[model samples]
Target: MRVETVQLKGYTTLGVGGPAELWTVETPEDLKEAAQAPYRVLGNGSNLLVSDQGVPERVIKLGGVFTAWDLNLTPRNGAYITGWIGAGAMLPLLVQEAARKGLSGLEGLLGIPATVGGAVRMNAGTRYGEIADALEVVEVFHDGQLRHYRPEELGFAYRTSHLPPGGIVTRVRFRLTPSTPKAVREKMALVDQARKGQPKKKSAGCAFKNPPGDSAGRLIDVHGLKGLREGQAMVSLEHGNFIVNLGGATARDVWRLVQRIRSVIPLELEWEVWGVIE
Candidate 1:
């Protein structure tokens, strides 16, 4: 029943927002109660854009009690390992955990900043990888109850998981093939290296999903939108698809820049770009 004001700019990766009325949920029961409070669920706050006017609504953020990790080995499929990871667990932590356990599937998502729940919702991935591929089942809370959904039921697709909107993922089970820990580490290092080449400042990761057979950054770069700035929000000089906060960026600034890019790209190069913004 505790309500606090949140400085959302500090809470999000974008670093540009006002404040939210927030409540911290420490347990599933707490989450259930908070979910009924007309608030948006806030996970690691990486893939969202908040209005500068701020989130006038209540926000529910879950904490570490939901971050448990468990592993079990199976005999039927050449040392398959099953990981039951909590939704509140950070993506990088889960990646490293799976790597340490000699599981080979999640190495491609090494440096992404988000929680498992967010990753499950967005099906977050790079060109060669996705979290949904390795998922066997997802435990979720919806409609005031908890349920498990198999992969087929999840309807996973590019950059999206087909959970009914507003459903909260509580845990995810992964099916992984066992490999040598050294091998897993090598693959993860490669992913880290690739990510290191991108902008590493205050950003909301990729601003646009790549269109089929082409890259979003390449298109934006071709249009010369890289390094474009408006009120402290700059289109990254290093990666066009990313807009970085340059000390005083606001949500309106970011939104305007995105619209400018989208408006020009279609007319100039006949390329369609869609951005996910709040």
Candidate 2:
């Protein structure tokens, strides 16, 4: 285990937050120690927003072996390819691996910048598919006890999965169909194409979850809230549901903009916030 005072802004995709004590844990025992410290886990920091003032809790980051995944598929069953993946592995790495190995799952998650553990815990997905579709079991280390769970036990929803408070995903099992590399790459390309027009600027992806039978972006667009700004934070003109950092935006700016949109549309937030804001 290692500890450092890291500027959280440098870690998050949205590019906000200040300094906080961050622990990098490489072993299972290290994870337990950090959890017992009541530390919060940080992955790729996608779909997350931290305070410019700094995070309230000590943060835990995975490194070393955690970032490694083993898919060694010399398939006994020609129909399916399965493997245990590390929590710290990025989604794009899996997507690329899937393409190379001709695995026909996780291709739809091509553009999401998320860690395997975080993505699975939240059931992250696109319109094409979700992590749950490929997920079989999750290996979790919580309160110094290791446990496993299936998709049904996690109570997965559109973009939510119920993990015990302070639970940390250690690894996961993914079952994927065996397809030709050409086919998998085609699917990946299709997913990439579907994601066009999102803002290229710094962001935490979609700020709000889509409401039932309606898209939050559509409603925000209908309300003419696109291009709305609060300090350096602004609703992206490209996509209404996205709050883009114009540059040097504080966490408060983003939170204030979120409140501004919620005042009008009453949408639920999708991004997980790590600090209190006034």
Candidate 3:
């Protein structure tokens, strides 16, 4: 284990945040040991936004053994394959691997920046599909014990899951079907093409979840909130649901923009924002 004051900005995809007491665990045993105490587990940091004041909680980042994955074809069921992926395994890499193996289910997640564990926890997805669609089981460590859980037990819905409190997902098993490589590639191509409208900048994916039957992006856009700015943060012109950090944005800058949007929209239908804000 390597311990240090790691800058949260470098860890997150948004490229903005203060420092945190960080520990990089290379083995499962170390990870479990670190979890024995109160700590936040970080994956690719794709869906997170830490405060500019820095996090006080100890942060544990998985590595080495935790990034390994195993793939096997089911016996007598040549059309089906099972993948056991570690929590730290990158989602985009996994999608590419699935395509290379002629797998079909994960092609829709081609461009998402997340880990298997994070994706499962958030039920991450795009219009094509959600991670819950292919997930079979999740292995997690919580309260000093490691356990396996099925999707139903997790209560997956929308962009959330009922994960155990302070639980650290260690691995995930996905059930996928066999398909032609060309078909899988084509599906991935479509997914990539659809993402063209998303800003290619520092952002924590979507800033909020859609409200009921309405899309958050549509609401924000229709209300003329796109391009709205606060300090260095601005609502993405390309996608209303995204808040991009322009060069030296702070957490407060993003929060200010969020508040501005909330002021105009009804509270009952307000977008649910994520991230740690002080």
Candidate 4:
């Protein structure tokens, strides 16, 4: 609805970035009206490494009608617990709600940070599970038209869901397993306990997707890269996959570090480390 210069730090979980110039749209109608312009969507900014130079155009972010969630329990066919979840609903909140409603599947996804749409798009999850497993269908708006993709049609990959290119997710329908609330809470607590010792400050979850059997953090740690610093950006000592911004880090510093890591890993182990950045 309103366009302006945005400091990337405010939106990202990493607390590092520069700026995005142009309007930010909060509604689908607003997005449609400005469809002629080049744009990108930003969610809760959990898993992104923004450029220091910033994107040169509009970044449409859905809000308002975009952020509602509805839960339904169908008694037919073994108590199917379906949730019509909004794109902007926070992932943690969804997990919390699911646990409250006796949904067993989302317990492993407790500490993730992002809107439901972003989680669905990226297929965010831990080693134990991923969001796509429980997704039934997702509603998206693309090229001024609305469409729905069932789980089978969505093309769930390692960390990607093959939604139509340029499609903005509006809502997700998830069919969850019915379990006792106590059982769900216990599982959630286990996930929480695992996350408790990790640094809780600014971070973008895991910086790199794991390379099959090997973890990115383990690789970086083996290289003696823990607490490695460049300007204010430092690879976290506790978790090598995370790059922490100690107060005043720039996107360039983070990008340079990522480049350095990628270039060095192969030279050290003769193994390629692939990752995505935006």
* Poorest 10 consecutive residues by lDDT, candidate 1: 267-276
Model 3 Cα lDDT, one tens digit per residue, 1-278: 88899888888888877888888888877887777666887878877777887777888988888899976656333446475789889999989988898887987677889988888878889888999998878998888788999889999998889989988888888888888789899998888898889999899888777887888889999999999999999999999989898998988897888789889875232122234675
Q: Model 1 over residues 1-278: C-alpha lDDT tens digits?
A: 46799788877888876778888777888888888766677778787777776766678776756778786655444546475678888989888877887888888788888898888888888755898877888998888888999878988887887897678898888878878789999998778777765887788888887777788889999988998887889999988888899988888788888778888775222111112345
Top candidate when judged by TM-score against the true structure:
2
Using TM-score, rank the candidates from best to worst.
2, 3, 1, 4
Residue 87 displacement (Å), model 1 = 0.5
Error of 1 at 7 (Å): 1.5
Clashes of each: 0, 0, 0, 2
lDDT of 1: 0.79
Which whole-number lDDT from 0 to 100 does residue 86 have in model 2?
86
**lDDT string, candidate 2, 126-175, tens digits:** 99999998877798888689899987888888899988777888898887
In angstroms, give how far residue 12 of model 3 lies from its true place. Answer: 0.8
Spell out the clash pairs found in candidate 3: none
Better of 3 and 4 by TM-score: 3
Tens digit of per-residue lDDT, candidate 4, span 1-278: 77778876777777765677545566767768756677777788888776665666566676776777876665445646475788988889989888887877887778888899888888888765788877777898888987888878888887777888888888888877889899999987877877654666577777777877888888989999888887888888888877888888877777777777887674222111112233
Whole-model Cα lDDT per candidate? 0.79, 0.87, 0.82, 0.75
True-vs-predicted CA distance for residue 116, candidate 1, Å: 0.5
Model 2: which ten-residue window has the lowest total lDDT?
A: 72-81
Judged by lDDT, which candidate is best? 2
Q: Which ranges of candidate 3 are over 4 A from the true structure?
A: 75-79, 266-278
